[model samples]
Target chain A: MGEKVLMKGNEAVAEAAIRAGCRLYFAYPITPQSELIEYMSRMMPKVNGTFVQAESEIAAINMVYGAAGCGKRVMTSSSSPGISLKMEGISYIAGAELPAVIINVQRGGPGLGDIQPAQGDYFQATKGGGHGDYRLIVLAPSTVQEFADMAGSAFELADKYRNPVMILSDGLLGQMMEPVDFKPHKTEEELEELGKQHYDWCMHPNEDEPNHHHHEINSLEIDPLVLEKHVIHLGEKYDEIEKNEIRYEEYNISDDNDVLVVAFGTAARIVKSAIDELQEEGKSVGMIRPITVWPYPYKAIADRITSKIKKVVVFELNLGQMVEDVKLAVNGKIPVEFLGKVGGILFTPEEAKTKILENI
Target chain B: MEVIAQRPKSLRDIQFTYCPGCTHGISHRLIAESIDELGLRNKMMGVAPVGCSVFAYKFFNFDMAEAAHGRAPALATGMKRARPEMHVFTYQGDGDLAAIGTAEIIHAANRGEHISVFFVNNAIYGMTGGQMAPTTLPGMKTSTSPYGRDEKDIGYPITACEMLSSLKAPYFIERVSLLSPKEIIKAKKVVKKSLQFNKENRGFTFVEFVSTCPTNWGLDPIKARDWARENMFPYFPVKNFRDKSLNGGE
Candidate 1:
């Protein structure tokens, strides 16, 4: 176990990735996420690893694709617009069933939106941003500590499922400072053994073996029937993940509570602060923070949304994108309200508290 | 011993779904032969770009990755850096590399990633039913350029070798023709040497193979080769734009 240290959220993510056995990092510098790339560039050389400043966001994602193909632990980081540029590569990685870690320190969007913190990319992260029938396991972190801890879990899930894993945070998480306890690093030998066992599709030379046959890594199938079969297999895997990997946290949700606040990532942090304030003011309000956005804890919300809960408020940085999922989870048994900010501006705890009070 | 006529040892035995006379088969064979000769069959990982070659993952016997169009070079960069012990390369077409992937290729070369690039220039989009390509010569007719490629409107062809040679980081840049037996022989040598350089841990290497599209060009295979040699070659000339080995020898 490494000593606990105070670090910014972006810095913690970079440190956590290094500790998780990731050595190959390719990224292009984008605001909000620049510190993560810079940290890797400095640390990789010291660790005898490789860090490359890619030409563009497109190149960075593709480089990640290449590294992942070789059965190595790899990662990349970028801001909102840059992550949008990476969507095509992200789709390919998911389609090919390759394990890779991608971090999106989200900012305002729509087109070069803003460098400020925003959760506007919730839909793009959970939904298939690129063209295809595929899903990336989206992990949303609300605190710096969660940001550090989830990096290892993200890589583990990526390898376990042979899929892409995204750490969906925002500029506030990237910029804010907090305490973090570093995880133990996996040894090179351990990683090599893991790669050998799990990365059967990787390109390692077959030597002194006549029975060894060639393996291909591709996502193209011209025939509709063949493509459909492949898609069905992926769907089965996604279902399995949904059953096993759904994660969330409930704070002070009781039968007596009349309002439930649902949020994720940075918005959840603000919502938590708001909940604290409302509780101080003696209001019956509770919060639910989603940790995994894709394999959402829908059943948990549904089970809790009994007749006692009068309303559910969905707060995000986007224009009511995640509100749709919240409505589905609540099943319209109660009214759903939305409070959102767009183009990179983040909602404050004070603002959330005001919205909750207004609903009450 | 009876010789078996099949795919090369470096290539999987899976039958390619390419149309008859499609140059992708020839290009794949050349690449496989190069890997086999260089004894890099085990250490080689290929990045397959979108377009017709999206299934390049199925053909190569080595470990392969499928990348979105124009992103193969970027993927190759990451793969090579992650596993420097392995040789990384990307197989891309004109549309994937020259058009949509233009930014990827330029930066990969500029960064001097220790990888090789096998760029197949067939002028027209083969997978998408003959659309206009960035390397499509002016005045050439295609589904998208039905009125012919107007230089005043669509711009002239992009010479990848010449464009890449301008980058100081690249160690080698060559443009070869794959239309004739002699040209095929020459192209194979270029391909082999590039892989050898990769095995030696040389810097970025790029090879552009000017190929033919008989079906897309609405011509016979023989005429397609002839048309390419006469039309495409003059515009996108065939030659070694840069070679560290040649410079060292000199």
Candidate 2:
């Protein structure tokens, strides 16, 4: 109902989820993303939604699986280790073809490495956190507005694809405050209509209708041929998503640019500041931000490489995870260089500029 | 043509893969009968766990979900919450419930999630070939406990009914044996009662069937039944641990 309000990225995500008709939320409190869960806990009941503070991250994700299977817009939030704990459930949800949203306000990890902000979960979120041949629709939000907007988009994509969608934000975005607009909320009527979308596949024990078959939500395929066919079917779905859903944002990538900087989320924000300083100093530098981390905007980055641009620079808050994607995108068209800050350390805009300047 | 004994409409027309004399088929029939008798066929949703009864979803004519290991309770919780209008239940075995899924079962019961749980306690892991379960009787020999279950090394068999009874949120908790015709009749009543409670949207309800694993127990069907009756009934007594309806809630 609010036209404009100053909100934290985490809170904005929670508010956006509520507006998008996320009626069921399950979570266990984790650092950097605690506000999201707390906001859901407070707001869900008021809106006649269910909020469960589950026993563990494992339990929370499973609860998401349950609600999603029942054709409810469900979500869960957690930090790095918590997300790792949820991998098993996530794999199951993916295998079962359930639509749900997971917010990983990532922090330092490799095993509870630290509580500070980091982008170390790039591989986990995009490639596969769980043990299956699966991919989540990964969205990386750099601003509070994007954080809020992506929550709505996440549900849409998830429902459209019948897959899990993740908001892969770092602690910086989660903790930082910015003005956000919460409008165009899914109305009560719209929400009711949305609930009807999954009626065909959702678990409804409609024993009265003789023609209606039992909707069994399971991933186990016993026969080898059947399992292979199922996996191929899922692969086809992912291929469709890949063909349709690649999203990114480009800044100042005109012909004058000698080097292109590729980044995402908080790293992109820092990279933007660095690019600004570089441009002011008469350097040809631009930034390409991949908003959707999964469908990693390879073409967007690749298409920008002109005769003048000789190299691609990737700066991330992790230890060169997305750089691999950048390199693959470049495909030897130009050399790809990586600059990273790990262990909860965020490189300053000046430090990033220094790296870019040295690279050139 | 008199139909004194026929498959319940809630059951699919398929032969069970269970070992001859295994109580899973009987238990499935009783549950199906209850669903039919209660007229809950259209609204019944079942979650089958990873054990001998993992294929329970296939046997049950109603809509069902297959969960990993002991996560059936968690899966059922999601189903019940998302669609409260549908009656949901989880069918789990001893290893899946008493051991690996201890947390899920306990917490779901504690939260008073509107779901019924059918726990089959047969002391051994039937699906995985006689591995020792948490409900394995002390001194009982299982594949994992070749030398017999040592209480010091691994705690004594957990009594599921007794454990769940301690939780205040649960509306009903009962344990029954499936060793004989008489006991089977009693177990059926408990199953029906649990389902009835679930139909009313009463909080968490549970029924533990003290069953036999003839193949896993390396005994004839009759011998396995006798063994369970002699060894397990005394430990996991057949009775309701908590009935909030009678006492008018906790």
Q: Model 2, range B127-156, lDDT digits (tens) per residue?
A: 878899999999999988999999999888
Tell me chain A's TM-score in each of the predictions. Answer: 0.97, 0.98
Tens digit of per-residue lDDT, candidate 1, span A48-131: 778988888888887787777777788989988999988988888888888999999998877887799998888899988998
Candidate of highest lDDT: 2
For candidate 2, write residues A290-309 as lDDT tens digits. Answer: 99989889888878888888
Model 2 CA lDDT for position A203: 79
Error of 2 at B144 (Å): 1.6
**How would the docking of model 2 be graded?**
medium
TM-score of chain B of 2: 0.97
Q: Which CAPRI level is candidate 1?
A: medium
lDDT of each: 0.86, 0.89
